[model samples]
Target: MKKEESFSLEKGEANQELDDDGKPTRTGTWLSASAHIITAVVGSGVLSLTWCLAQLGWVVGTSFLVVFAAISWFTCILLTDCYRSHVTGSRNYNYMQAVKTNLGGRKYKLCGIAQYGTLVGVSIGYTITSSISMAAIKRSNCFYKYGHDKECHTLNTPYMLIFAFIEIIMSQIPDFHKLSFISIIATIMSFAYSSIGIGLSIAKIAGGAYPRTSIGLPTRTDISNMDKMWNIFCAIGDMAFAYSFCAVLIEIQDTLKSSPPENKVMKTATTIGISATTSFYMLCGLLGYAAFGNDAPGNYLTGFGYYDPFWLVDIGNLCIVIHLLGAYQVMVQPFFAFVENWSHRKWPESGIVNKDYTVGCFRINSFRLVWRSTYVILATLVAMIFPFFNEFLALIGSMTFWPLTVYFPIEMYISQVKLRRNSFTWIWLKALSFVCLLVSLLAAVGSIRGLVVSVETFKVFRSMS
Candidate 1:
């Protein structure tokens, strides 16, 4: 028995303390859940909101931020209930599991595709975003030394490789349950960078050196109607991306303690998390737009909107790099877990796939190391291939926003509650879902158009200006 226990521990299969559900004892609370959500939600997505506000202008942009936040919170409440099946009254460990338990069959399979696809896309997006921040750090210093007129051009590929190396190491972390510390650190880094961005914007506007402002739509004569329309749609998509954290809602909730009723605790966490996130989003997006007006760069800090106080700019960019390091793991760990768990189940008898070796105090799984490192490498390669920050952000956001954020949650809720067809509640839910679908479709079209334009102008594997 002692030898068997040691083997299990070596294989990283030991769950010494099981909860009433016979799983690892969950000590997560509303606080930790909020941290995880904030870490996931307020990432590179926040950086793009200034550009988003530029496209949509003040009224529409601010309204969209609030609307998206409300929608996310509402659907999140529904999703929280689906954490435990209505019939079985048992836990569904992940988003896919919740869908499978409540709305099984084709819908379950669909949820997997949307959820996992979003995860993979988000990993790539983080790669691109982090690399930009890394390069921005260098570029900011270059301008400070060489004068603003000097072309401080920096290639993003090298920084991307560095970021990938870090992710490759981070990917080895066993699972989501162990990422609370990283999440906490990431949460702080997010606020640090966001606060910095807000402060810089405020300074710029107060200095009275900011660009001309716009109240309604961006009526810039330099751009045509087609360009304006596309920008608006893409802006909506970026907003969608900014407010989205529903894909990981079930996973985060699963980490919470069960005593207070996980659903109740999650709802409260969702309220607090989304509320705080929205407040930050508003300040960052609006203040950034206020500072730069219609000329706001897709990435405000990295776009060199603030040239002086170079050290502070570098610090904010560094914070972004550190934050993304943890954010990448938080977003990608679920995908890693799904793939590894599936492999273990499929090849139960395969020693190479199932075995884990002890490295000092760490348990390193052979299959996990190879598979996860490869995934990070591939994601890095893709990020290098298409590093258009805003366009990629919009594409990923539009693709997953409706399905994972709005559709799956609503469908699962209706199924679990057995709501009658065309009932008042059902009609409104379906209507909201339908409206979001249209928004996503329009945003996707705009994103694809932007990508095409970017590719036409940008040289593949070449340095981004």
Candidate 2:
């Protein structure tokens, strides 16, 4: 068989003319793009919102959610235009490419470290979250078999390995454009778990046995003033993490067809996706906090809010596992593509790195097979080593939120449109960026402190009940 025929990324596209970037022709619509966005944006982070909301109280927590969503939406609009270069009118295949094109120099390198690092961190976070959901399912059943107060704890290592094994196989998917079905299913699972959480919260609130409520900060007497400050910062970090998904916006947009123009389609998709995500965030955060007040658990579903409805809780957790399976891929594919593509360029003649074998209908690359599997295993190891869910989420969110989500997009947009320096729009954008930088710094500090406390009290691979 011919080399081209044997190593094609997608079948049936060998005969078609390549896209402007010499890749397969894109067939994604706004709807498909929306699905990908929803899958990537609305993820396991949603489960932690109620705890964050509880810490921030009703006023600040709710306000932060709205503010973060608006910021993410606006910056995403800026990023969509950067998908295609202004001077060359050529497509920027990924976020790094978009940054390099518009904001070249050392900033391009900085964007890469931040973007890819965030992607890898997110993958590890997902692995940890999926494993927790799996364990939660087992514990939920144990509680049903025995009682809610019974000692029923499960180990997360085996579940993390199971999740890793599944990802190793799914990571064989050739390209981002080929992930529509997975994204669609993951998006459905996201909605399913989110809806379940909201429903459970509503039921709890309606039962009229909820905990003490608060209006400003959490009113718990056990929490010290410094602890309250850190919690508030960490909560803001969680909200920031919940809303920001710009890292993958360009990659998702790349899958869209060019007839209606990719930028316009992506803008519409961003609006719709962010709108849907924010609605879920608001519903879950508000209702969950209302349900449990200051004592809301970090994970609404797996945190044992309702043990009576054991079956429903199991289903909700299963949905989370399934959803993370896909969300992991959606977020990590770009990182995979970056490393694999670079390896192919660097060692064009190395068979192990460049060779692709035919496995039925799919073309599997040797480098992809080895490296992708290795990456998943390493991520699983990290997940097991430090499975601090809320703290980990906040840390990753705080680290990447400013540069990747806010600064790069804003700077790239300014460069693309040639906004005059110190003008009203320039001043406004700079001020926004500056404020977000502070938020990110504070969130990072809070997350680090939380992680420190967690590490001091916990051992490696500690199982939870």
Candidate 3:
């Protein structure tokens, strides 16, 4: 059979087909792609998005969300275009493979390292945030009044260790095909949580349970004119930083069975996923800010006072844990592969166990055991020490996310389009590249401003106390 025919046949098998080497073929239906993309995009960002929006009021906040969505959508399209242009024809053209081939040696390695680092930072942030949310739920009046006294409002070291153990075991399961099913359920739960919470908050505002804040044009008190411009710019930057996961998107594309055609399925799925996420962010932000008014909490979802009727806060916590675990698996898998490859390169005749041990748990191989042990220990120490999920997330977003999402994409565009002196049709790509760079820079500044402001505010409160 011709190679093209073999490729087509493999595509027909979708995610189930294995190549001669026993690797699963990347072909997948729209559902699989959508699930992977949505899960990748929706992480701990959903938790604090509302608070960011509240700072600008609902109208402005929603507007900001729309603009951000457009930019993200455009960026994704451009990225897909780049992938199609540079990497589609080759049989081995996956995301990282494409980067290695198109961008060449050092750039690919640097981007890969940055990508891995960002994912690890994000995973740590999510784990810590989820634990805090769980603690908060336990401390709520409902749990304390109704649950077992010993279980309520207690942070038991043993329990945490057990939880960590369970998470690790669950994460080691080899059936990645099942991830799509799990992601679908998680996405549904997220939608339900957002809908119910936003609806209830809106109802309360309408029924006069909470006073509605004026939502017109900005005022001097809202922020100085100079600060308003800065805020708007910063808001855009924050949104970019929050949504930046372009590297992950490349992975999503590579997972498809055939090279993605410019077909309806890909277009429709991408549109729906991006639109829904942006709308969810906007609604959650507006209603949350409106609900809290001037007393709006810094963490939108959790800080919204009163009980969540659907037990959403709890479910949200669980989802965060699950999502983080998945992300951690993806982040670590590459390093594991690299290490195994290195060992095999040195000792070419070793048993498969020596090479495959990195993929699973077993002490016969010291590398697997030592690395996993180190990760767990370091992650635990960080979570225990810093413990402030929001600040940690902000820091990661500023340092790691901005670099990967904005800086890398701009660099990729410049290398692929500008350096090649590509056609005039590529002008918009250049414009977008510039916009991403500008947004990333401004976001770094805003995040620093926010951190400093928080410190100053804390000092004032302490002095007063």
Candidate 4:
């Protein structure tokens, strides 16, 4: 078979795939690409980073944050190279398709399962986060004055319904390229929440507002060494999930104009995006720990002492809700596209395509309306059912880190970037790849253990309630 026939990424004449409302006249600029990455990467993950840092203490957690940032950046380089692997250097619709281009056949199946599962898992996480943020906002008015009022009446389901209502409108716009306008605002939303959290931490420190019960630091003096180590592993899982962006790299790259060395432009965008993420993570994680120590809340907004500047707290948290509303769709779009693609392959005659369709027998395209909404509803329902779901989501997310973030990228680089056999560079890359595989195994096990414990504890709390 010819090299051209062997690869699916080389969609020659069909390169001009239209978004729902518009045709592409030019390639996406690096800034737009950076915005998409920023929107996707810096979601609710930034809020709990203080707790992550506390779990590992400042030195270790900060180190892991930097390390994960570097690792994420490196893997991003590898994925971009894979995006340019074809002779024509065309883009793949997803990482799975890109892998199929190189490895061929059902070799990409695991990628599909793991990739889509991770995305759906992320979507569920956003559902939970948006509800929590809005719920916090709902109860904020009565927070400090707990004794003076009726019990704060807030529920996760209703807030999730509100989010679903908003998403239904956004979901109607089919392609992610169309989300560029929304993503720029979503990127600002990350900055909004992170900046507020940082400002609050500084204010507390300046005012000397440390609580006597608050832990100054998590250390051998504060806890057992076993607990310290366990928490560090948990932090690893947290940062791993936080740094995950490779799952959507290809789809983002596809929107960019197909030109020679466009992947170079992608590298530039990755630098900007990940650097912004690192800055926010460091500021929030370190300052949050400094302000509250081990007593920091899992969600930083609520962790504040509920002081007089409660209005600022509400603004930051509402930003979280707004951010997740956008980020949820960013993650979910890949799952939506994957399912849509699957349906098209299975039913080539189906009218649930990007193209306008005639109402042959049915009044409308039920698959388009029903299937998409069904998944969104399903994700929202999961969020409603499992209130204590972050740990489980982290577990599922960690499942993708090794393969999607590290192993696949390194493997593709070794396969696609030819090097002299037995050369020092070649040996070193292989060794690093092997080490990542080991680390991924350990991280996955730790994440799973955390999930199990969270489930058991949730049940215990449920029984008491």
Candidate 5:
């Protein structure tokens, strides 16, 4: 029994080093955790928030953001409870293990699928968006110099390949917890682009460039109300995308200061992260809507066109590429953990674990070089082929939001924690989880419809132009 336990522990978590006080040394503060959450939540999704606003108009869109924020906060609280219950002062290396610990292997399979798929989707989205943002800058310059019929040479394919090479090299880091510095930079880059977007919108409004109006809605009563409602759900998916950090929560919690990563710290970090991100989302969404009104583009910054002050627009897009570079790392590192954990179990005789101090450990090892590079390259090729950015975000959000963000956390809490059976609180919680599942179903339908529309509308094999 003792030998079996030792093997299981080693497979479950590689890093179990004790501190000088004979206690498990925790590494991150509430602030760093919050920063990591903020970094995850506030990425390229913010770029399409104006398009969300355009879908639902100002009143409905802003309300949806606030609602999702509240839901997300509550989800975090549930996660903290699960961590305390399942972990109970022990080390938990990843979210999958946490789920399997509480809910067993059957549930763990679903959670693992959703978590890994969601992270891959996010990384692919960033790759596609980063290259598109870069190409937008080049297109802007081409249009400026060559007028409306500019045959710009810069397509997303080459840039996607370039970013894949860069990201694959950076992803050679073995430990997910050590990504805190990169997450910090990602958080700052998020703010940089969001603030710049807000500034530009404000400048446009103050300069009498923006006229008050709403875009993407029909004025004609002849159009079906179904169309409007579908758009509303699509917008909800966008807001959900903007607010999703649950997929990365357990990985982020790996750094919490309190052993077992206590509730107060997680709650404080959750509140801070959610509040700040919501504020930024609302600001950018509202201002961008006000600035562009009914004519808002799907991506506000790129859609700004190569008019006057083109340099500022170009800089904003460049910052997005930089931000996505960091955000891509933040999102994919957890996936890397999942991969490495599985690989180490398969080849236990080999040293396939994190070597923090070894110089060669950080270099491009054959396993990492092959697996990670292949992962990035596959994502890049997919993005290059099917470049439907906003719809893809919504689709990924709808697929995972309920399972990862709402359902899994709450169900695991009920399963693991000592909740009174048949009590009102427990009943209410069950009902809420059921409702979230229904919501997820609705969002999935909307996502499929949105995806179909996007595919039909977007230029496939676009570089073939």
Candidate 6:
């Protein structure tokens, strides 16, 4: 086959057929298209989603999830149609690409940069949270086994570093196809973990192992005005971040060869994935709050005693860490590829080094080494400085999640209108589009406020410490 034909075949296999400009043409199957969407949506966020919801009280949190899910579903539909209409024949188009195509190129570049920054921030946040969760499990297990060694009274930095190293190494592998299998495992494990925790929590409540009380719903007076605003903002931020991955559906659609049958399958799969994620978050949040009442720590495991005989939490933590590793890989691969493309002179097109000094031993060119080291050091420092996981999550959601989820879809829809005037028929889509834009904007603003507050709170806590 000719080069174009060869490229086309490989692209088709990956669910992406490139146009002349290297934009993906819609040609892949639905399953292939939705894989990354599933991965992107189901990350460390799910693990903490329950805790975030619990903070707002169960009723509010559950309501937020339903509303956000509905909004996200509608947003995805708008985005899918937008892509089908505007950049239909191009494989080079992504969310940012769509923005650049319709909006100014400079704005698109800025958005792309913001997206990368947010991914890095998110990766660090996930690492830190996973490390803490892992450490909790380790400390609990050690105490269970060694019965609290007085001589080993030092902080377990080694364990954290080891886990971080493992994650860093795992994230460097290039191929996401193989990575998706791991994600499938992680998803299953997450469900298993949350299910067991919920069941155990419920059983304990039933048997009076824990106290349950109605502290009265959160009244305006009960929570201070400022606190209420902060909580509402946090909820909006959570929703934005939770639903942000909706923007990725276009890339996924491109990979599927844009087959009509595949589109339907992708839509169904996307819905199922979102539904499952929402259900998991809601259950974990409700059960978690119900079990511990108001004293419940943000992490679900905190509700249980060390002797709770529930090995699922530990297993779940481990599984989530693994899943996050996979997630980090998916999130960062595009960045890596972009970097490689930009620095082609220093690095060859093929056999790019994937090793990190922090985690693995491998030969690295000076350029690659410097970049990799810089990324690691910077990411580590930020994570350590802002050691609060929820705060980092909020920051990421506000800055990156908003653009990807709400803004990008609106832009894509407008672009589609420009490209295929009167070609498609969606009578309610314009109204739906407006609703997405409004909610997304609200969520983004609320998330930013929450992040600002969290950072300020962190600073205060730091000074006190």
Candidate 4's displacement at residue 428, Å, is 2.5
**Segments of candidate 5 deviating more than 4 angstroms:** 1-26, 86-88, 147-154, 210-227, 259-262, 351-364, 457-460, 463-465
TM-score of each: 0.95, 0.95, 0.77, 0.86, 0.88, 0.76
Alpha carbon lDDT of residue 203, candidate 2?
82
Residue 241 accuracy (lDDT) in model 2:
79
Q: Please, what are the lDDT tens digits per residue for candidate 4 over residues 211-313?
A: 3222333554666676566555666677788877789988888766544345887898999999999999899888888887776677777665356476888
> For candidate 5, which ten residues in a row score worst on lDDT?
12-21
Scored by lDDT, model 6 comes in at 0.59
Q: Report lDDT (Cα) of residue 262, candidate 2.
A: 88
User: lDDT tens string, model 5, 1-465?
Assistant: 967655434333336454322445557778788888888888878988887887777677777778778888887788876664454655455778778878889999999899999999899888878887888888877778888666665667777888888898787766666777887887887888888889989988888975546443434353467866676676677677886789888878766755433567778888899999889988999999998875577788887655557777788888888778878887888888778768778876764343223455455456776788889889888887677777777777787678898888887788876688988878998887787677667766777787787677667556421
Per-residue lDDT, model 4, residue 362, is: 35
lDDT of each: 0.88, 0.87, 0.56, 0.73, 0.76, 0.59
Clashing pairs in 3: 26-256, 26-257, 27-256, 27-257, 28-257
User: What does candidate 1 score in Cα RMSD to the true structure?
Assistant: 4.3
Report, for all candidates in order, the number of backbone clashes.
0, 0, 5, 1, 1, 16
For model 2 the TM-score comes to 0.95
Q: What local lDDT does model 2 show for residue 107?
A: 89
Cα misplacement distance, residue 85 of candidate 1 (Å): 1.4
Worst 10 residues of 6 by lDDT: 150-159
Better model by TM-score, 1 or 3? Answer: 1
Locate the minimum summed-lDDT window of 10 residues in model 2.
Answer: 6-15
Candidate 1 lDDT, tens digit per residue, 341-409?
899899999987899899999999889999999999999999988988888889989988899889998
Model 3 agreement with the true structure over 106-205: per-residue lDDT tens digits = 8778876766676666656655655655554554545536653433444623334544565555444333343566667656656655675577668667
Write the candidate numbers in order of decreasing lDDT.
1, 2, 5, 4, 6, 3
